[model samples]
Target: MSRAASPDVARNARPYLYGGEEAAIASALSAGQYNHGAVTEEFEQRVAAFLGVPDVVAVASGTAALHVGLLAAGVGPGHEVLVPSFTFCATVQAIVATGARPRFIEVNSGTGCVEPAEVLAALTPHTRAVLPVLYGGRAVDLTPARPTLDTRGVTVVEDAAQAFGSCQGERRVGATGVVTCFSFGPVKNLTCGLGGAIVPRTPLEADTCRRLRSLGIVESAARRAETTTYTVDGFGMRVQMSPLNAAVGLVQLDHFAEAETRRRALWRAYATALDGIDGVALVDADVDRTVPPMCAVRVLDGRRDRVFGELRNRGIGVGVHYPANHTQPAFSPWHRPLPVTERLGREIMTLPFHQHLTPRDAEHAAGELRRALVKADR
Candidate 1:
């Protein structure tokens, strides 16, 4: 594709649509099965099979996946969940949504992931769960901390919104035993326009998550249609993935291998280009095992703001992934000192990343960063 034909480097990220997506959406519309339908169920099954799991529960969005997963894990009021403060606020808000306090933990600066020691150290008498955010699509291995967590009865629910196609050890991310949640948002590795899924640990947990997403209705949609009465058992929310979005997801899943390959190649191209550049350090994604969502770097010497400004002025897209959430006004009541996250808030920068751009685009973006760094220092 020509530079003009493609979404140029000025775009930080956008959904990469393969052929037939429009036709799939049209077919779903023609069927007129907008809500819980055959299409959505098929999407769920395909996702479960791909991850080598028995079942996957579909939901409206990634946040919904976290909320439902937490609730299904028996997390509720009077509980404390250990979580990293370096991630997007949605992770923190999900804990708050469950009426649980988030005990903020720190992450390693190089990978932007919570270390095993951090999880082990943050534990308290009220701790009920450990929520690990898979930043930049890199898997966080809590193997060393699992024994203690299990002994304490603290469940691990991973926030894998950015880690859809990434791997952990021998199996893919969601296939791991822990309760994992994934987002199929527009710009994610897999796009459903707007959707998410939960990989439950047991068949029982799967049923609970399904019920939670469907407003605690005891009967399935088919079962309810044959009867005059439907039972609402407990507190739940209406957040099922729509058939329209599922149609898009099925098409995207068919072409997911291409996404994995291209994303890895683009990340490598950026790594090669940025090598030996002073005043910048690449945030390692363990690219051999990660399908990176973005190429992140730390700009040193308090130069990130100026470098970001320079790139934007030159029409090269640059972004900050997140600000520290613990210090936010809404979460201040639960705040604990996180010095590493505070420093990362000032240094982290993300370059333009998406499947639409080629390796040449990666080179161009890195070149622009090098030039901006020179300008910022002078």
Candidate 2:
């Protein structure tokens, strides 16, 4: 397939970076009260509505949302949380932040998600929660183990930072889990510049999350304005979402459907273009259920480093979704022999898949990748 007629896609420029949405954010800023107020509430309400959940509490970052959700779920010292080794460091950090031990489990090589069987095997009496990540925005079917967890009294907190509009079976990712955490960081599907949110199953859980976000305070200006006086009840962190970030988030939310459509199209383009390349294997994408947040492929036959180097030499920007978290120095003590995660971390390579890339750009990138693979083979 001669797919090389496109103009040069900028090696450094990502078509979907956030500067283009400044006007909407400026309009929200003009309303004053740039901290946490009506704008924040509106942002939260919109997120809650989008996820089909009852409540959403915005916080400073995705990590903070996970920490607060764990705390709100009553996870504390001596508790254990089952986490996937092949994920962003935030997953392990959240468990550690709650003063709980993270029982690292291996991921499924095919799906890049935590294996339910491995998670079940790791369950202990001290197990307080199981955090399954929606890696690359794919729907993770937890139905297979739900009954077992329920019987064992284990809570499921979904780490859905990469999956905002994803659906599993018939239920949205956030709606079915006891608590789900989302990130609005610069690179997430929804860019708030820097923020996160927690979706809880019930009103009480929602209220607790709200308190935890605001430094354990039971009341704030937003809450008091509805009543009379403000009150502080418990210790809290300054994890409240800023009006600035929320304003940006609201605009992002407004355009989310359109943005996701573009993203999905890009993913399909890459998948089609890269098919049958002997050295590269496209990561499994459940198009019907996932709105892929990143485009990744496995560089097979031990040529990962050579291909990665060649792409960089061609000025094509690539990324690694993560290294195996358990192998990192900070979390090494928790590391066990996770053969799949260790190997996948070495083989995985993330290609650019964002709202900005045109079909032609995708083709050109794939062409370059094909050339790189041929060179590596030689």
Candidate 3:
């Protein structure tokens, strides 16, 4: 296949390097500081500065961030954490790992995110936390239920894995006084290769997160290096982000503004191309505030499967972001009827989206999607 027609649209998501990651990794390797070290600390500080937060705790993966953030917020056995059934399984798993039951909830099909009313209506006496997912790089606002949550002593720990660099109104997602967690995975808005960060609500919580990620060690890395003994104040996990990954993150952070611009432009292109298409409705991410991680559309008329297969055959990457977790065998114990989420599971389809793609690429993908939808209708 030629470059222009090489099925470049076959990729649903991919990591885009700014040509500095290789050198950064090389430098990190040469320093021989493979474990958590100065590079990791620098990355944490940089992210803290970017989010305008007092501190940010780095961890091994987005799942780790979720796990520790929940733990830090006092979620554990016999507790119920409100979560949407429409999110990636990892979100539910994190709740499970904290020994909490996931009280499955529904999302607004339009944006695939949980709403404050849905959360407010689902609360029970056991409700200890609300883990709102930032679906498709769109920030979820649960402010309407804030007073109730606070009065009831429930914490809001955000699963913002896909929303790095995205905003929540006037301020950024992490700056909204919530326990926001972000993933810098290979295909996220910001790639740290395989890393995540937690924006704690206070300096004390930040310290708690740091200790949690590093196996409850009371002493800092520098302090441990100088002392023969280290203290373990409580239960914890070995999930700290490695210096090597942090090195890559530092470089990615430097070019994040360009990433924001390119991703938004591409998402907008898809919106324009698919504007009047029949049998489909775009899942709006409020692009003005979101740095969209994917362009999702709802294939109406019970045609999502057909359209998906058609697009795949045409080499236009298409996928379902999630299958409703409530119906999944693993989560059946807490299963509740989420009719809206069930329908969303059947309809959601994501198109190719990545920094490597251009506006032209989005247009091409949208055109192919239209063709697929028409074929399904036939």
Compared with the true structure, the alpha-carbon lDDT of candidate 1 equals 0.93
lDDT of 3 by residue, 84-154 (tens): 99999999999999999999998999999999999999999999999999998898988899999999999
Question: Model 3, poorest ten-residue lDDT window?
Answer: 1-10
lDDT of 1 by residue, 128-218 (tens): 9999999999999999999999999999999999998899998999988999999998899999999999999999999899899998998
lDDT of 2 by residue, 205-300 (tens): 888988888767787676667986677787578898988889888878887888778778888988888987787888886876787787889998
Error at 70, model 3, angstroms: 0.2
How big is the positional error of residue 197 in model 3, measured in Å on the Cα after superposition? Answer: 0.5
Candidate 2 residue runs with Cα over 4 Å from true position: 1-20, 223-230
lDDT of 3 at 126: 99
The runs of at least 3 residues in candidate 3 whose Cα sits more than 4 Å from the true structure, single-residue gaps closed, are 1-6
TM-score of 1: 0.98
How many residue pairs of model 3 clash at the backbone?
Answer: 0
Error of 1 at 49 (Å): 0.6
